[model samples]
Target: MHLEETETMHRKITDGVYYVGVDDHHTALFENLWPLPFGVSYNSYLVVDDKIAVIDTVKNIFTQEWLDNIREIVDPEKIDYIVLNHMEPDHTGALPKIAELAKNATIVFTQKAAGMEESFYNVGLKTKVVEDLEELSLGKKTLKFVHVQFVHWPETMATYLAEDEVLFSCDAFGSFGALNGKHFDDEIDMRMIESESKRYLSTIITSYFKFVQRAIEKVKGLGVGIKFIAPSHGPIYRKDPTWVIDHFDKWSSPELDKHVTIIFGSMYGYNLRLAHTLKKELVELGVEVKIHNISYSTMDNVITDAVRAGVIVLGTPTYDAFPFPKIWAFVNEMEGKRFQKRPIALFGTHGWGGGGVRKLKKYLEENKFEILEPNVRCRATPTEEERQAIKTLAKNIAEIVK
Candidate 1:
């Protein structure tokens, strides 16, 4: 590997590879669902050899910026192959523009992505469908494709540069944060990256966790040394690539942390008081607890904590004879994500009617969550007996987690 002074615009990965990705700071939400408090990045790579190849393209909105980044390295028309690792718009929205400019470039992707290419852009240009473990020689550099289906999408695959030992993992190891000129993992605050990565995993890829585990095992089975992991989002893992890999393995595994997450929707502070009381009991019992008010907290954060915790507790005030709207919405979201089953405790308050706790209990049980004993329900405020029941509920949860 050779070192060169970093250019003001693009940074070099090694002698021939370059980072041509773009940062997105304007989009307030990721996929129009998850909040983007730290923004996000769309990473693309350019491999310069005897035959130049562009790994991926950024979102259409950042076409000019992406083009300018590549133009600084080589003429767009000189690109020999445009590798489509994933068909998601965030990574392929600029494909049509690049294909138009690079008239001679042939689109290279897996057999599955070939059909998606036409559906997405229909550029009608030349294309090459490669098989898994197939290698494409670009003079001095050799690129190998590994099929890792359903890392989040069935058509997803990762490219490996044997010479440089860099894995161009599309979304398999991605996070939700912009590089902001800090492209390497060691250059930024990793604590923030780990948290955001967990949130990303829970929101985007948790449903396909089994696939994630298989992908990780397959990549490891390849027995290739990985010098860097360049994903389509967030920073490149150069310092400790295994850190991200191991974290993904653990997050996808069915193991839970010894902690509790309490999510509540309180109307007029009745259920809110119950949530606090439960928290106090759990804390005095030496069990860690995370409390979230669904009314204001984003679903992304709540899900992140919920996925990590060993025990889950819900408190909602009855609304229209059902669980509170926000709490009900959260439960639906968790159901879609298909989180690992854990012990759950339910508590709620009602005025004239009392069906909220019952409905919640049934739904949670149907979803495979083990219901803890003493499912507490009360009137507008908790009575002395209900308070005792809440404490008992907390004790049972702590015992299970411990």
Candidate 2:
């Protein structure tokens, strides 16, 4: 690779179709993904044909590299259109700079996306707002837009190239890894990318799955042969677009495994021991069980499993007559997201007067979860008798599901 090509990995997907993938480091908002600890990538592409079109721009910090990438493909001034699949800064932060470079290029986006442009950059830029299923001609090539609202954002949409069978999926089917010399889905590490993709979808997009299901159906209805899926982040899906479609299909459905997720926060070992007992008894009843110590587990992963499991059991030791702070924070986050219609059971280790279980039960009921019978509470460290009582509670949970 030449110095210029190394700086910007630009490859032609087919005759007259090229994509420039840029790397970005976002340390603040996406802290959970970093340094190979958790990961994220900001991807942009440039298409060169009879008329040049730049798909999306990278972050402001990567503006120079992004612009240089576009320049390598074609003179920025010759670019005809800058497609805005999403208005998120990770994708649109360099829009103003790109607009300045691509002087006369028209900005194509949904109506809501056009409105978002003002918030991101100063006024006075030419923009063309297209509605759902609207098609625009770029010389011999044409791109169509499909409105996909609430699949993370109101202005989000998927751009389809009629001739190439490629879909520029914004954040809808993206993962959390940077592409290292590899651009196509089949060429890269499948297991790692698939796991990261699931983490991203489960944590960030799980709440709006119904809209995602509708969007999937919409894409399926188009009857277009999607040979490539170029998302705004992670490696582009070229070999298998159906892989992402399958993932979205499974996640968007309400289907869940016959497993129980028991999450708890305990200052001492009392609540922890109770959690183990509950898991053991549930396992004995032929139910798959997962136990997470809240103090150690990341909230994002915990919530991901919670959303996938059929039953959720929360155990928190009483602190100042209320649930532990970590548990409180977790529940607060779940409530803010409007989590609904799941079976939940609450238990706590308390001293003196035990009001934490009752308090938690009330809050759980308010959040639309069906509170199972008993809502088991143990006084301080559970004795053998208390352990036996927990076994009965686990049986009740199994019966409730059955």
TM-score of each: 0.96, 0.94
Which residue pairs in candidate 1 have backbone atoms (N, alpha carbon, C) closer than 3 angstroms, thus clashing? none
The whole-model lDDT of each prediction reads 0.90, 0.79
Tens digit of per-residue lDDT, candidate 1, span 339-378: 7888889999999867899999999998888999999999
Which one wins on lDDT? Answer: 1
**Steric overlap count per candidate:** 0, 2
lDDT measured at residue 388 in model 1 versus the true structure, 0 to 100:
86
Off by over 4 Å in 1: 1-8
Top TM-score hit:
1
Which 10-residue window in model 1 sums to the lowest lDDT? Answer: 1-10
How does candidate 2 fare on TM-score? 0.94
